[model samples]
Target: NPRDYKSYKLLFGNEKFYDRSSNITLNYEYFYSCIDNMNISIDQLMSSIQKLQFMVVNLNSPDDDPQLIFESLNSTGVALTDADKIRNFLLMNENLPEQNKYFQNYWQPLEENTHFEVSKFFRYFLTIKNAQFPKISNVYDEFKTTYNNLDFDKQNLFEDINDFSNTYKMILECNTGTKKIDVILNRFLELNVTVIRPFIMAIINDFVSNKIVEEEAIKIVELVEKYIARRIITKTPSNALNKVIATLYRDFRQFQDKHNNQYKDSEVIIFLLLKKQGSGRVPTDEELIRNFKHNDWYNINSSYRSYIFERLENHNHIESLSIYEGLKNKDYSIEHIMPQKLSSDWKNELGNNYQRIHENYVNSLGNLTITGYNSKYSNRSFQDKQNMEKGFKESHFVNLNKLPARSDKWGEAEIIERTNQLITSALEIWDFPESTIHEMIEEKEMYIYDGNETFSNYKIHGFTFINDEYIPVKTWKGLFVELFKLLAKIDLNPLIECTKIDTKIGFESAIFSEKTDDTE
Candidate 1:
């Protein structure tokens, strides 16, 4: 029996019996014979013994032996096929009555302790192993339960599980034959379902970062859809998930540079719409359809269009204006002031490149405004539209001009100038004083001197100045107070120089008492 043990140990490269092998030929023959006689396959037996040895080493002294075992297993050039069999065998053995007490005394406490870095992975592996191979449904249930029990505000429950699951999947796929069992187990313990979105994001980010699977971005979109659906139904939607999806879609569109493509534009538009709307409720199908039709959102990707409308509806941003009397009424549309097919005369006057300029500026609602009389001036030019409504009676629902006209031919420079003008107009409309307005065209020159002698002179161009000054005077405190009150209205500082002056007055008085005494 000892000789048989020696032969077996030699074949398996058992460290304890290294000296037992003197002849390579004899060792090899003995190893093959043992494999044939035991009616066990060489691969199977080696795997079994390896796993047993690994478990024994770690169980004997986990603090030290686990690391050593990991190194040995990793260095042995063991086949993943064999490693997997050994792992399965050990996992099965964990449930044995004899091993239960050992696990409770050693592994259980380690798994439960949060301070240990490996505890999470260790516990997860044990749980999964004990449960056997779980179906997706079972996994989902486990995730839901785990999520329900967590305190989200205190712990970032989503990020942790997402990382673990991704790592776990990678390990399962790679099968590198390294027995980092403790690491694997720790990951399993830390995992929960809340991490699904983050895991998807990580995968998408990795793909994008590596540029390995550019086409796989579609898969990310599908995953996002699933995540959104699940969260909406479960009422546990993550704001982080929403923001990530929005940002990812935006980046993807930018990478594609599909500016003219309706699909790309729709995706960006939808993302913006959803972001504008706050979270919680999901939009109804009818509401989505209505908004899309009313806004002329056709020729765009249907799914993306619906998503934006839905998000807006969810936040109550798309509700009827009549519902809230006090709130200002707002309606959304895509207004084209210069109709797409312009007349030859207008185009010639505007410039031969008018189509491009018009598309750049006149197509969007930002360049348009809400007016009650949509039918009367749907596609009129600025001048014509103004003339048509000049004598129109004022009513509560009267059509007001939406956007100021482009004074010159529509071009890049003209568009930029008009945009700036509109912004300034908006500021003024909001009660900004003319003096306080920042003038981009003007330059201010300042002269500074030391002891009234000029020392430095410079001009600060394209910057606005704010004047803050007070008067200093003696015996004119009342005047200073009045000056300040007046200065508040005028935004310029008052320049004052102090000077002293004296005045004399002549008067006559009678003094006869002293003179009369001298005479007496």
Candidate 2:
């Protein structure tokens, strides 16, 4: 039980009570039993056991790579693991005094904080900073090499590692102050994604450095939660998520042109996310609504679907249900409105379209909800469930679910309508705020045309800005046509399409590069 005094329990059988008296009593009984069974003297048995000596192998080589030597020695037979190797490698190069200092300061604190999960934490840290997952055994080698390439010297390196470990622990524990972010992180944790950690770590740095306000930080983290959740719901290629989030710090840097820093981090993150058009696209409300209608609620990971249920059930309700609370207590379970095992009454309620309704709506969002009576009322007809103990009407989700708003019969039409309603609510819950839209500037397409001027005195005059810089069109008509042909592909947007301007020829440096060709 998580709420137990230990938050965990260890049971003892009293058989291994290792007191001196018990030890002697057990040994004497063993010796007496041996003597009775085999006619062996107690003294001889004791002497034989005492004569056995244990051999210890200590491997040391200043010339060899300690890691290689460790791997060579530690096989299936030994207790040495990747974590042990990492600890040894990190400490091996330090002087005696330095080694003890580092161990007492950086290493011990992390070990205590992570509950001796130091190796796993180190791998997570490496993955976050490097954007690539490391093999467990190679983590120390990767860390050693990668740390050398970084800007920090040895002293700063340890300090940076310690600082990052603290952030990792905060995120891993979901101890981030705000309730909303903490809840969202709990959902993320349940989704079994540690890939988002690198991105979160970067954001936490931004928070610590005052690059973004706390509210904006929350918005960014929440958007990522929705981004991953929607991808899971739509069954998109999740391998793309790691790549997207891994390079998030790089993605954030792309916005560092002059006015970029003036924008709120929420705006920057949301715009960058919206601009992702391929597999990385944060799905639009239309896409979400469409997918939610058809998504198989049962086939989805229970944790993910449970998160969706919690969001649905808690919307507009003051007393929120914690997913953690549910885990620690018998609180809620996902209940299918249209039972998985259909009764005669359910078939009749769905009418002659029973198979169609069953196939489409059985595991769908419209027909599923959070319920306290899942085990008790499961598989009953909707009407029977409505009448059962702690039934649908009493469920906390009833207000949000609005079950009876449609039809008492709960058929295909009602299911479709409810699917639409729930999806709209989902959009409201997970949607990125619309106020951030103004932060993005859409690149408008531009077109260039030869101005109507006499054959001799012709000039490129599309706007006053361009016409104003009247470099007379003469032999350069060939130049402009060549330039226009080089630049134009039907319509060209200066921001989006101008690949490069050949600046060696002075005409290529013409003001037209910055000007919009306003004329048709």
lDDT of each: 0.36, 0.67
Which 10 residues in a row give candidate 2 its minimum summed lDDT?
A: 1-10
lDDT per residue as tens, model 1, 155-209: 2432343344444444333221222332222222223232233333344334435
Looking at model 2, residue 431 earns an lDDT score of 72
Q: Compose the digit string of candidate 2's lDDT tens values, residues 29-137.
A: 5866767798667798889889999966555655656556656667558667556676777777678898878877887776665656777777767766776667666
TM-score of 2: 0.70
Clashing pairs in 2: 446-492
Give the C-alpha miss distance for residue 208 in model 1, angstroms. 40
Per-candidate RMSD vs. true structure?
Answer: 28.6, 14.4
Find the candidate with the highest lDDT and give its number.
Answer: 2
Give the poorly placed runs of model 1, Cα more than 4 Å off.
1-144, 147-332, 359-369, 375-377, 390-414, 421-520
Q: Tell me the number of clashing residue pairs for each predicted model.
A: 9, 1
